[model samples]
Target: MGFEEDALLAESGLIIAPDPESARLTRTITGTDQTGAARDIRIVEERPLTIFLNSREIVTTMTIGDFPDYLALGFLKNQGMLRPGENVTAIDYDDELETIVVRTDQPTDFEEKLAKKTRTSGCAVGTVFGDMMEGLEGLTLPATPVRTSWLYALARTINTMPSLYLEAGAIHGTVLCREDRPLVYMEDVGRHNAVDKVAGYMVATGTDAADKILYTTGRLTSEMVIKTALMGIPVLASRSGFTAWGVEIARDVGLTLIGRMRGERFMCVSGEERLVRDADPAAVAAEDPRSRRKGSRD
Candidate 1:
């Protein structure tokens, strides 16, 4: 399936349990209302998704259903677990077991790789520490210069992206792109999982890191930031916001952190140099209507 299709699949996560307090709510006509005919009920569902690396179960995440294969692959890539050319061969769902199995041919040294200490991360990536930070710090990203205008446009298009969010308004989404075009859009109960699916899709299709961009609907936590940096996407955009750590890591790694992208406004908190800044001296005057601003961050 394609991006929207994959996202739809991921959004179908299982509802594992119901809270007695919450389950008690129901919509019913009430005399207090003007029309006295409106009521609403709410319930939450959780699905168990297992990501397998070369048949070895690497991780399990609770997410709303849909893109199992992409979620698995994206998770691995961002976790610094996936390497180049480790194509995922198959994705199978055992309905009876209610778990997804992802198959890949990538070679791994799990015992050795997992030796590092772990730190708390947001979402299903509960804990991640780059024990291999030395090697990871050397990740070479291609010089894919994206303008601030393109960032603004991508953020704009992402708002209107077709997915369960637009259809159901109950899922998180992640989009993978090449310059102006959106290549993949994955959605799940969790934003991390959605991005993971995109990572998996990129690996399966041999998409290069230097040629892609990542977009999400969730806040730019450290995990999300690290994932985008690892994927070599110089810029990561989100509709939500970012944490202090997220901004810090992006600054250190030379990645751009763009958040609060909605309507016609956004904040470029870090890596402003990568963005296409206004060059017109007269426009600068219009921007400040005061002192002449410096042309560069000198």
Candidate 2:
């Protein structure tokens, strides 16, 4: 069925979940490289999307022009606009207007929330309310283990996969993994958007998070750490470094935080008790050249 038909069904009762394939928009553009060489290259298309909740305008975000419905839902979910178990009536996306309207059963009043917005360090510049951390104290993630073998395998698998980041440069990726297998891989200009899409996908599908690991190419910033904890996911891994605040929160909430992961090496900054050193570091092979990301050099 078409999106309009599916949207109607969603308004009736069903929620439209995000599929991994829905988040890709590619275009070819001519650019000049070093040595004054002109080349035609495919790039990820980006566009601004203004989202409205019911009749009130919420926020505007630059997205990769894919999965508007899921991106909208996920953005709201992470921003603390939509509460858990809140009935999402319908999500309508208009391509021509570049807008998405999400209808919910509960009424939303965000005048105060919008007034207290703060810009984050996310690549696309993520914003959150001053009181966004209000409910984080009550969230305690499950006690999940990060097996050495699983970590090695997951990183290699994700690195080798054909993704939007590999397809076009200048993008970040987030993956939801179970042990050695990556189930959902999302990429966007902003790391927050990528992770939010994964969050929205989880909410729509009712996926359990207790045993899952959240991986990202973005830094382990406070926002990333808090979002993963809110999703009830216990483990967070990244190929980047961590902020001090990010480390403190993870340590306090007992979220296993792993960073600087390249090749066969990684550092778990917090929740060290959850890591099982089952695989020998010497036995692990070097990172596959094809699996390296543009942003991993740091």
In the order shown, what is each candidate's alpha-carbon RMSD? 9.4, 4.6
Where does candidate 2 stray beyond 4 Å? 1-24
lDDT per residue (tens digit) for residues 83-189 in model 1? 56566566777755766666667666676555664654555445453552433465644545666556655655556544445433445667776665666676666
TM-score for every candidate vs. truth? Answer: 0.71, 0.90
Model 2 residue 167 CA deviation (Å) reads 1.9
TM-score of 2: 0.90
lDDT of 1 at 196: 70
Q: How much does candidate 1 score in TM-score?
A: 0.71
lDDT score, candidate 1: 0.61
Candidate 1 ranges with C-alpha deviation above 4 Å: 1-45, 84-90, 104-108, 112-121, 124-135, 278-298
The candidate scoring highest on TM-score is 2
Q: lDDT of model 1 at residue 201?
A: 66
